[model samples]
Target: MNARIPTDLSSSLKAEEDSNHSDNPSFDTVLAARLSRRGLLRGGAGTVGTVVLGGMGLTACGGGDDPAPTTPPAPGTPTETLLGFGAVAKSLADMVVVPAGYTASVLYALGDPLNAGTAAYKNDGTDTGFENRAGDHHDGMEWFGLDAAGKASATATARGLLAMNHEATTDELRSSFFLHANGGTTTLPRPAAEVDKETAIHGVSIVEVQQAAGKWTTVQNSAFNHRLTCLSDNIQLNGPARGNALMVTKYSTTGVQTRGTLNNCGTGKTPWGSFVTGEENWAGYFTRASTDDTARGGATAKSVVSLKRYGRNAGSRSRHGWETGGADDKYARWNVGQSGASLDGSDDYRNELNTFGYIVEMDAYDKTQMPRKRTALGRFAHESAAFGKPVVGQPLAVYMGDDSRGEYIYKFVSTKTWVAADANPANRITTGDSYLDAGKLYVAKFASDGSGSWVELAMSNPLISGYATYAFADQADVLVNARLAADAVGATKMDRPEWCSTNVNNGEIYFTLTNNSNRAIDSASMPPDSANPRVYEDTKGASTSKGNVNGHILRVKEGAAGNAALVFTWDVYVFGAESGAAAGSVNLSSLTSDQDFSSPDGLAFSPSTGILWIQTDDGAYTDVTNCMMLAALPGTVGDGAKKTLSYTKADTTTLSVDTYVGQAPTADKLKRFLVGPKSCEITGMCETPDGKAMFINIQHPGETTAMADIADPTKYASQWPSNAGYGAGKRPRSATIVITKTDGGRIGS
Candidate 1:
């Protein structure tokens, strides 16, 4: 009765890295004759010193003559050290855990109705109207405060709207309330009902939440409560790639619109108050027949090259096969192959694949507004976007990372200088169009000397135009085929870049380069660099894997050039390893029982207390402990010393390398905060403006449950957030947990 479980089914396997290579540019030593960290404090402070005073416009800056504030900012108010709550013990129980004086409660969960008319979730795979309920697999999210009139308020802390992306569905055995029946997979064209149900649960959810008596709960029937699914008809196409010929399809003859968003992963908050949802792993959701690659006209030789590069090669099967259902356009649009009569691909759904993989902007406070795909930001498995604090009359900058093995990191700089009046705008999407719609996208190229450059991907660049293979038409083509363009310009392929977080007090950026198995597969393979400096075998239970299984975090300092800088210094902040690993080679952080972790994924910086939070999405270390979240007080890039790494391969070959490693973590410096249940990933977090409450997401519990015990309630892999002493059920659900201090004080204070 159960479909065969895929042995290769993985949540994080996006792409192979060795396919692309970067011409590592030569540069001088990072810390040699250049101005040292101490020299900056004396005279050359520039943007680095100004940012350390509380970012671009977040705090006031004065000259030397200006006196300091009468009193220092409060301990929990974005400028001081974090020394409030004791570290929580790491746990594997099927429940949310917190520090001693904090409480964790489920605010909203999968299948929970947002409006009054919808029925509660049945949790039996028979429920309907998922478009009106909270979606599944909550990931990237942001908090938008609501004013007294229920409009978008940037200041209100107690009441606001939470917009979260439902990344993807769960495995059937691991989760009982999954979308389809009989193991949730079928080769025969999927049933239309199952397809519709699945589509309804894979987008963004906006729910109104408020705190009363120190506990937060959703506001039932609130006008702000809404769900934007993969089936929603109001998603509009915008920016350079809006009306391109490649985007034309039967659904949109003018290529001006698309139905929904897919694989919404990491997210960002726009300066003008909007939720920016990034599309990750969306290429796996379409079907392309084998013969389509040989077709003429719209299916040219360039199409074949681009499709294969993007992992949508000929004969590729859709992830869930919604295109295989009944022949209606609703089902047919999921197919992205040549079956149309028109030459420009307007008569069929061949171009439907071009409509996705974008950064979508939605007004969380306003439900009736349509979501716009800001294509100028460039696509390619977007993980998260972080904007530098805006400054008046200065260019706005946004940072991004492509979440695939051997992928490149990117940044976008707007042509127009920011005007302070636009911060509190009447229409946010209009403001977004002014800035995000017209920007120059650039890919990063990291050098061996601990410095890096941002290579512009515009058509005007000779490197992109002179590339002989793929044809470059305009800016639209460059943005649409961003990965190819990045490859063309020789951007440095990273070790699976994921969530990016920036300090509130300074513009220094930190991102997690989650483990990559392809780093050292053979003698000819790309070896470890200073940024990704590990190659070893990490065996969990019976499964064994080599390379950088326990990933590391990369820290970048923008220096005097600021966010728009082309050259910046970089170093490895910390390396994830077991407590018993070799000191200088593997266990660089010198982790102890309470601080050791593996494969760091989700990352965020507290705007209130300047603390860095690290979460895990790891299979490499699951046997030793469940996935967890940790908090640390970060120093700077050069605070660490350089060390050498050595590894012995299976073929009896030995390799040695050197990398910069951070200071050893003490009990007070880095410690585990909370741990999730069995087979779950801890991701997507946001906090109230007052820093009193925090919201974190737990995704895909029991994902490791075997297919044999799926139907038995007692044998279910995990009964979390529910049976973990919160709700009542045996089925596991991905839900958001709210953590607040029990004494009504600031969190971590």
Candidate 2:
């Protein structure tokens, strides 16, 4: 669902990178020359090398002129161990198909009751009180166990609080609910009640769930069961932008607080006990009047540049018309137009757009506390915030990805180092305030030779201060317009970076670049780089799709400096492609028929087993198989050989695309573990501390069906979880499922 919005800034930024690097030789050219000279080294000829922060190089062998260690001093053993589970056959069935020994059951579904007063979900579209029910399009989620006293418990597996994000909505119209009047089009103003119901279902859900006798059920009326929507007043703004003049609005004239979180996609858990929810695709949910740009900025070049770079240009209408619901400020805030008094722009919601698109941190144990927007993490289309292994009295690192094509990866190092006593603290918000409230953010600039550097995004940087279009006034300005700062520093444009997970074993980081359609569309956009090595055709029914449709996962090894490391080595862990494609071409991993997948979206490493779970949200190769999830046992970087692909150009010429491919996947290494129902995406998953229960989210089933067929239940694209005997209807709904091994052993073992 995050890929729905088309990124307009992608091409412009790609073009900027092309022109910026035209005069200076590219990183590939420099690395190629270095490798050519190191050809004499027996094992270092074709492998990825390391590049230090100050333009120094280290060969794979220990013979480079620069004196940093050629081989990274190895870290301690990983916290998790691999539990090998045999592969499950791929399927397009209208059910969740897991491996031979696994059994899955619905724990909760959209419209399921969260309060004791609400009736069970009818699944017939007449259900209401979505404010007290499960939200739709569940994306990222995490588990925080609770003891009998209702505090954060690390090992309490049977009873715990499950916090999950409801990212977006499915297109299936509800005929019974009045919300579907006129097909629920955003072109016209919607009814207030209809809009209120829709708004209530678009945030995060915190529910208390328990498993007894192998059955998981929601604890209705539990105090922990609550929902936070885009309309909740309990959300607060923190960090440097808090109380800043740029954030003043009618809702929060002091700029210290605002209403709810929006479009929460991926989620992360802090070293202290809290949930870090990434707000993504939130820019497309606000409306800007046709004349808003010039009137708001008033010829200020910096203001205009910041507005356009964040896709807040005038005449832009969001995907919904919540602004048209009524004259109330609750709905009016959705419209970011300059309609009211303009002297300070505080009478209207003109500054409301600046409030969203942040990583919101919430204390899972303390529901009374307000959610804080960690603005120090830089504002962008954040996909996830993964913290590296914390060291006592050492700095903490949080990695994040902006989930738009041609965006950059970011790292935030806390100003306050980690203190061992802070872990499992009595109050997580206080811990968050100490570490997350202040930090130095850095953007990644990857090179072709499997090496990279972190460019700090500071206002003190000459490149940021001297940026021609946007002038940086202070740290807050740079944080507010993070994309501009990343562009000024020339960070490597990734292919829609998504969920990131740090290897608990070695503190190595991995992120999903969830495909970019703009790359190589023409000479105007970016061509395939060594990092993103695919720009081939993937044909679907009568139409051919280009660009990296089948996305890949990247592995990063930080230098011995650990969380604060400025230099790192990297390589592609695996490439997503059709199994039957050319062995070494599009299917770079040499996947077989049963192991193939596309658009690797949701990626999580099991804390108990260390197995990597890769989920897909694909339309590229859906004709042959539905979206699915796989279990992978990945080797470290540089475990495989270099790869090269010859691309036949439009003019009948050929271009060679060479990249560092990781070890080839085998049946035992990476295998399909589960296939989702038709039209659904397998997004988020989490495991119990004991590793007995695994929770997975299936989102947006029956999404492809036409809204006009709402009256005909038979025309629905899927009847999942319901047909699987959970709910009672032919309509499909997003639901959370629990998977466990039949033998009562740890999952995937």
Candidate 3:
């Protein structure tokens, strides 16, 4: 998610580093066998797409060929057509592009002052006071509206607070070069000042913004404006894993407190009106010496197993080399190696990595409230935590995904039932404690029949209690090492599940499976399965990419219309592809030029209209177009039928798979809404209660520029925000853009 380019590391390689190499059966194989048993696999094929299972109608990868009956709208629900605006054409421009009749304006940008005392940003790589300025790489966000009285108002339209994740900064040669004068230092013993600034920008920011005279601007000195950086104090730890022996670090001897959040990627708006963010890719921030295993009791030790399972193996280099900055606690905390005499890890930062990888909750309206890490959700490369629709007297359920190749999807059901009054509780953090602290964490296991079951990850589960691969000492261990527990229970591996969004209309959940490089048609270790069944090569100019090059969206409907249901039905909602891709296989969704997109990442359903907004962070298709955002009207899980795809191998033999595909989206139901600036990712979206105003983040524009060329504006991949006449200099900055209809009507209408 950072999308930051380093000299020795490419984005694709960084993604591959966290891949799941377990031997769990893939959904592809399961779906193939299920279709074969149903007598649906066609004998000879280049790519056969029709396969009727039971009474469901089937069709190839062609949209509008077979229309299925859709679930009628709920009582009094809006019956308007889904996408109302004309599609925005693809662009390679250095500025944001939206449909005609819409105006997009920058609302916030990196280095912008959050307080009146902070000096205005010059955008010349010499800015400081990041703790009081907008951070880099604005990501997954939520809007908290405020009424005229300056109090919380769920339906307010003219004023609100925007809480977003500043995931990471652009880094290369051991420095976040974009934030320093003359590109900073690129060698070992990184300057403490440079490290300080970098650390101050890698967390979350909550800033107030208001509309006045038809223009929107951030309230620089508003009381609601606050920034939580890696050096911020008083972030508490909650849930079952809190105070666990494995979590004891030098900074928190009791394991109940830790310093700032890092790599805050996808975000969630809690049912109790709190802001929750997922710490993603945090493992790469800590340096583990090669002798860590030896010091901690060798290869089979629990600490070693846990560290490796979490993708922090020995000798792993820190992403920005912050640990080499000196002996101060601020710098030393980045080192997770064993250096102290205490065996329980309370004397050093050996357990510092465990403090992160959680769903952190904070009351955006109250800056005094300390953010709390909800550990019951089970730690991994968390992308987002999307809660199911709350029904009074029922247990609350939250869905999450581990954003890595071959990882599993997880769900947490709170033991306590929801209460309507708690929606506007006296203290939001306490309300979060009631539901998020105690829960049953379950991992998904998809079967071949388009049905899946949630496998509990508690010690009571025989598979977990008896797991020989990694012995689980207690529930805390199970939650801390959730990946291994899911592996033990035979959970189905997904293709890099990124963000989960719940449809307000029907409560069905949608997950964006961002593309995976590890997938292959002939790989013995990781082959294409039914659920992840695309294996083809895509060439953008001379650079060729393969293995599910364009990701797809998957949706699931919980059984019995209950969020806590253990069983569910699922289907591939849409397969991302170029409109020109070969039909039936590569272009399974039959996407037209107006509907094609790759690497679906940020996903959120408008609570006002139930329209699902999808944003992308793609590399595979950047040669054709910059990352984009699309608006879609999705149907329920069983609305479509099953289809079988055949991939030809190098031996000329074909491997066939049967997969459940959702009804194809017509142009009216799905269309491109916006395209980002060059070399940037379009992520994080939120809307006002009236659906008249929309906000999206353009992250890391001009990110492809070489590190050595930081001083040359001519060589930058993009100059946007600046080119658009926004900031002080030519350097590009990640910023939030607000879009509204010039006709004064609801957006997309």
TM-score of each: 0.88, 0.88, 0.92
Candidate 3 ranges beyond 4 A from true positions = 2-7, 10-19, 29-81, 648-654
Instruction: Give the winner by lDDT.
Output: 3
Q: Which residue runs does candidate 2 get wrong by more than 4 Å?
A: 4-84, 171-187, 297-300, 646-657
lDDT of 2 by residue, 1-749 (tens): 34432133333233322222111112321011011111121111112122211111000111111123234235653232243444555555677766544677778888888888999877665566898999888889999998878767988998998899999775322211322433454346666766777888889999998887768888988988999988889588889988887788998888888899988999999998789899987876777777876776664656556666777666766555677889788988888877886565679887787888899999876789889998899989888889999998779999999887777899999999989988878788878999998989999988876788998999889989998767887887788888889888888777789999987666778899878775662333456777877766666667666777789999888888888999998999998877666565577788776578888888888898788889888887777778888888898988987776665556656666568889888766787777788888999989899888999999887677666676777777887766777766667888898887665677766
- What's the count of clashing pairs in each model shown? 1, 1, 3
Screening candidate 1 with a backbone cut-off below 3 angstroms (N, C-alpha, C), the clashing residue pairs are 78-608
Tens-place lDDT per residue, model 3, 1-749, is 63223546553236334546678877553111111112222111112122221112101121222234458568767554447666765656666767655778888999999999999999998889999999999999999999999999888999999999999887676677778878889888898899999999889999999999999999999988989998789799999988999789988999999999989999999998999999988888888888889998999988888888777788877878899888899899999999999878888999998888899999999988888999999988888889999999999999999988788899999999999999989999999999999989999988768988998999999999999888999999899889999999988888889999999998999999988777776666567776787777776666567777788999989999487899998899999887767667677888877788888898989887788898999887676678888888888887888888765566767667788889989878898878788989998989899998999999999888888898899998888888777879888899998988776667766
Task: Pick the TM-score winner.
Answer: 3
What's the lDDT for residue 254 in model 1?
Answer: 90
> What is the alpha-carbon lDDT of model 1 when measured against the actual structure?
0.73
Candidate 2, overall lDDT? 0.75
Greater TM-score among 1 and 3 belongs to 3
Q: Give the TM-score comparing model 1 with the true structure, all chains together.
A: 0.88
Q: Please give the distance, in angstroms, between residue 216's alpha carbon in candidate 1 and its true position after superposition.
A: 1.4
**Residue 536 alpha-carbon offset, candidate 3, angstroms:** 1.4
